[model samples]
Target: MPARNEAGNLPALVDEIAAALASRGPFEAIVVDDGSNDATPKVLAELKRTRPWLIPLRHAVSCGQSAAIRTGVRAATAPVVATLDGDGQNDPTFLPAALDALAAGGARVGLVAGQRLGRKDTGFKKIQSRIANAVRGRVLGDGTRDTGCGLKAFRRDVFLALPYFDALHRFLPALVRREGFEVGLIDVVDRPRQAGVSNYGLWDRLWVGILDLYGVWWLIRRRRQVPEVTEL
Candidate 1:
């Protein structure tokens, strides 16, 4: 989970995740605290004492969400990694199902992404997302509708091999496909945030996203096919 100033939401989200994944055997929940100024560090400290599965990491200064996600993925001990927003808007119950979907698709499925239904964002935000998604779809043609949804499951090695950038989290499907793997989608019901306001703004993503989109498009066009390797 990539979290910034999400202190109010972490405890409940952690508990919910534990409950949801308890039957799935052992797993680690890596919460990357992206330089939160609030009581976030303290809360994580407290949560850590009780929950061994909680792997709390902190950035010395605030990096964006993509950086945080990259940090968690790099540190992951599991071969498959699942991500969700740390603000409690993303339901933890969907993680197992997403992982299952990825597994069902076999080794070629590099990413299983969540498509949010009934978004709880303000009308303006939802409109902005719709416009962004449409533009991205036309430009990259990654066959994904809601790339902004935070819930995702993928192979840790595949994720680490992808080109990293500021907004890489939002472009996973395109990049994963560029690496010659299939993408899977699952419908996820959105929920209102448990606490705190949104950390992102229209300006923060708009211009950068355009540049990133073109970059990904170029990468897709210039890519070479993956070689089939057979060794003696």
Candidate 2:
């Protein structure tokens, strides 16, 4: 989890996710501090002291969400990696379901993305996301309905193969598909933010997404195509 200025939500979010993971099976949570200017560091330190599973990585300067995610993934010790928004909107209970989907879908499924069934966000934000998803689906042809949904899981190697960018987190399905791996989507419930404020607004994300979409499109066009080779 890449957390920034989430002091109010960190404690509950950490506890709930930890309990949920414990209920299903064994898992570890890595809390990456993206240079938070709030009490998030103190809260994370406290949680780490109490919970052995929690690994905390602190950034001296804010490097945005994508960088934080990359840092966390690199520090992960598990073969399978899962990510959830630190804003407390994503339910950690659905993690098992995502894992099961990947297992049932087989090894070809490189990434399992969660599609938020019922989102709890402001009207403008929802509308913007719908527009972005539609445009992205048409262009990327990734067959993913909700790319912005934060809850997702994938093989560590598959994730490492993708080209990392500033907003690559939002277009993970497309990136995974580029590596000739299948992408799976599962419906996950979204909840209202438990505490703190959302850092993103409609316009900010919309403009940034438009630029990123074009960049990804160019990457797809330039993708190398090679024929299969067999060894004797």
Candidate 3:
């Protein structure tokens, strides 16, 4: 999970992840500290001592959410990686379901994205998201209603193959589809944040993604043919 200055929420969120996935099998939770000025780094350090599954990474300067996620995913040792907002809004319990969905679809499903139900944001924020989702879905035809939902599961290799960008996380479905892989969707219930104010604003939510959207559209339209290979 990518987090900035979310010191108050990390402990509980990490614990929840442990509770949700510990019994399933071996897994690691990589929390990227994106140049947080708060006690986020310290808290992660303290938590690391006890929870071997918790892997903490830090950036000296903030490079935004997409970069943070890239950092964590790169460091992850697992073949399949599940991601969610570091804030407490996303429930960790859904991780198994997402992973299952992705596994069920096998190699064809490169991504299993979460679509939020009953968003907890303010009315204006909801409106902005609706407008953004509509525009993005119509233009990209990604067939997803909530690309902004942070909960997602995919193969680590598949994720690394995509072209990196500032807002790559927001256009994952479209880009995954562009790579000739199907995208799966699961309905996730949203929750109000447990602590700290939201770091994203109007620009971060809607306007900033416009250019990235177009770039993804171009990439999709210009997709190269993947040749079938038969080696005797």
Among all candidates shown, the one with the greatest lDDT: 1
Q: Name model 3 segments beyond 4 Å from true.
A: none
Instruction: Give the residue spans of candidate 1 off by over 4 A.
Output: none
Residue-wise lDDT of candidate 1 within 1-232, one digit each (tens)? Answer: 9999999999999999999899999999999999999999999999999999999999999999999999999999999999999989899999889999999999889999999999999999999999999999999999999999999999999999998888999899999999999999999999999799899999988898899889989988998887667998
Candidate 3 positional error at 104, Å: 0.6
lDDT by residue (164-223, candidate 2, tens digit) is 889899999988888888899899999999888997877767778889998998888888
Model-by-model lDDT, in order?
0.94, 0.89, 0.93
RMSD of each: 0.7, 1.5, 1.0
Instruction: Say what the RMSD of model 2 is.
Output: 1.5
Q: After superposition, how far is residue 2 of candidate 2 from its true place, in Å?
A: 1.0
Model 3, span 53-110: residue lDDT tens? 8999999999999999999999999899999998889999998999999999998999
Clashes of each: 0, 0, 0
**Candidate 3 structure lDDT:** 0.93
Looking at model 1, residue 76 earns an lDDT score of 95
**Weakest 10 consecutive residues of candidate 3 by summed lDDT:** 203-212
